[model samples]
Target: MSLRFSDTVHGVDLPNNAMLPPFDDAWVTSWGAERRDGIYVSRPMTLQVFHTRLLEHAKCNNVTERFGVTRDTGAPAVSDGILWGVASWGIRKLCGTERFPAMFSYLASKSNLDFLTNGTQILMSDKRHYPYPDNLFNNRAETTPPSTTS
Candidate 1:
């Protein structure tokens, strides 16, 4: 699905090209930096929860392909999407549990910050394409964790 937004706020027509920025190479690089520097330290449990939530988000949105996951694997197949790289790195770190809430808050805040700061790009001309409404934001329904049977 294409990423595009167009809505009037207070009678002013919002630009149609205001779409969520694609998670590109620069984002990947920054993720690597965060991992190396331990800037956003996270515990193993928190990272697992984050990974699960991210995967569930992708699955619910039907955008698993974008993140490089497939039905057979049921795992992040590649580090193409923004969250994929972070999640993969977190799994590897397996850091001891501490400041779990802080880590989760950091991730959530960063995601929103990226969307607002990095995603918005204004051009002089008004030549932009806006995709039809896809109801992406509305599909964020709570996901039930996988059940285990012993």
Candidate 2:
């Protein structure tokens, strides 16, 4: 059976690039983010749901078959679309659960915050491009926990 929006493996389905809007399909779902203020301190409900769901799927559901499709060179393997790998770093840091390895790098030269909060369109017209729909608001450097030794 094909996956639907309600299909849940611990309450989430795997994702892919085709999951992008204008390209979404049966096994994948998509969402768009809207502008908001206090973006650093106040979580946008849209983005909160996004990163949260990604975390849930990683819990005890590593590389599940429920997410597999019979399209990978005439053999079936659990899907590993670009979306999964890209978001992995932040989510893993937040919850200590490793999913995909992040491929996105911070643009020290540019800021996504400005465009996300003021763009006329909710998503970039080229929705499939990286950092377009993703609209990364912030990135944290890998930091060590504080040491107790004086």
Candidate 3:
């Protein structure tokens, strides 16, 4: 059976390029920041759920069926489409349970955040990504921890 928006995971199927609007809005919200505020924060509610939903869609949906590939004989079963690798990265964040150095690197690339920014690295450590609608707002980093450790 084909995966619907809700059946496979926690996602809301949306129009094409659904993620664009939300991302742009988020970027605009933090426009005044002198630093890289475009780098969003993810928490359990936002990031984890959003990430899971996207990954589930990827696994359930056939790569060939969505985006066709060509054989050595040049036979095409599917046509070219959006960048699936980037989708996979979003999936990884959803499935991830613990924070590691690599996760930081991955989100950095996906979000186009500067690697040199100390704030970005800190955000990666604190927040997590979720499975969300049309890849919009996948992460919600915890703004306040239970306690602060100095």
Candidate 4:
């Protein structure tokens, strides 16, 4: 399913193109308890789309220049940490989604640069970084939305 960003996140409205990537059940489940806790409840496709758009925006706007990234540096080589921070700020100030604060909190807690950098590929490949006992959405009738309260 396609995922669209809310008009605003944390008082910031995202650009019209900030749509998330496609959904994947394996990736969503890989988030483990965070998915169940609602802290990482965004559907896998939705989150991926959001992240892809975030990175594309950063590249188009030269937002990575502030982080010492030069034009010579391949876009893919840029650190996800920088991108995440930039995207997070954008989501907080531009999109203003109510869940931005919660997402920010979750990011702070994880605080792993690699996680953000490799997250897209990892999720897309349906690989799990950490073992989860079960897929929370597997048995649920509604795998999206209503299942997540956050």
Candidate 5:
């Protein structure tokens, strides 16, 4: 089965001459459920492709977007919790087409985040801080529109 996901990309810095690592050791996590009508929905599991090597490969493949933040605006009082870049994902399925998108949508609905907006993005060299590799840090490039604050 071939599952491919593609979307317009923005805000990414591509790396030169890079190759991704294996997925066997990748990490996966869920954001939990959303309360609706006194019920909870299952949150979709987002696969984290941490391996720095893999991230490098993703950048080469054009699955991630690079963006520059407008620093002119005074820094936040908290000094944190601001988004700098995003990672977009494309899921290509080799079998069962109808069920895939629907199932994924259902799972994402439980997380309370808009699946379409909170997609994935490639990671820059500076974003690697976690001792353990995480999927959130790994991202591929896409041909989406670039994000610029002007």
Candidate 6:
């Protein structure tokens, strides 16, 4: 019952460290973001993470990639969204897994996302955000070729 989600990240500022905040309807409303066809594109987010809501909770050890997000506003008229980090969740120890891959990431269907979050969130963080605490900001030093992954 181990469920994992990983992807070859794109357009992310390398060495990115982010916190996908838990779904908060009020907060989203505050920023005037709305759901369309059951999806949300929160304007309160900056680079896949909340810009100022970073100190309200402790960081969770892991989280699932539950939905796709698109940024429809920016200088170029549309800013490509940020990275999609991985999670090794299994109904429990969701404190997950991530791999720096060189190619071909998995594309799971909506049913797959349902299997993970039980239909409560479209794109939510797992309740937390701790201090950046270090200069490296999680600089990864390892990367694996995509072909050999399990």
**Model 3 regions more than 4 Å off:** 1-17, 20-54, 57-80, 86-138, 141-150
- The alpha-carbon lDDT assigned to residue 76 of candidate 3 equals 13
lDDT of each: 0.26, 0.26, 0.22, 0.23, 0.24, 0.25
> What is the per-residue lDDT of model 1 for residues 1-150, given as tens digits with 9 covering 90 to 100?
964555621211122222322222311111222233544443233212112233322333342221211111222222223222222222223332221111111122223434534665422112333232224433232322222355
TM-score each candidate: 0.22, 0.17, 0.15, 0.15, 0.19, 0.18
lDDT of candidate model 1 versus the reference: 0.26
Instruction: Write the residue-wise lDDT of candidate 5 on 17-132 in tens digits.
Output: 12112222222122333334434454436521221112232344442322111111211111012122122222232111222210111111112122334464433222222222
Model 3 has an lDDT value of 0.22
Report the C-alpha lDDT of model 4 over 1-150, residue by residue, as the tens digit. Answer: 965667553221111111121221111101111133223334344322122222232233333222211111112211221222232222323222322221121121122323543663322112112222122212212211112245
The per-prediction tally of clashing pairs is: 0, 0, 22, 22, 35, 1
Superposed model 1: Cα runs more than 4 Å off: 1-27, 31-57, 60-121, 124-128, 139-150
Model 6 residue 126 CA deviation in Å: 25
Task: For residues 87-133, write the lDDT of model 2, one tens digit per residue.
Answer: 21223222222333222222211233234324633332222333223
Q: Which whole-number lDDT from 0 to 100 does residue 79 have in model 1?
A: 20
RMSD in angstroms, candidate 2?
19.9
> RMSDs, each prediction?
17.1, 19.9, 20.4, 19.5, 17.9, 17.4
- In candidate 1, position 69 carries an lDDT of 14
State, as a TM-score between 0 and 1, how close model 4 is to the true structure. 0.15
Model 5 segments beyond 4 Å from truth? 1-17, 34-150
Candidate 1, position 85, lDDT:
24
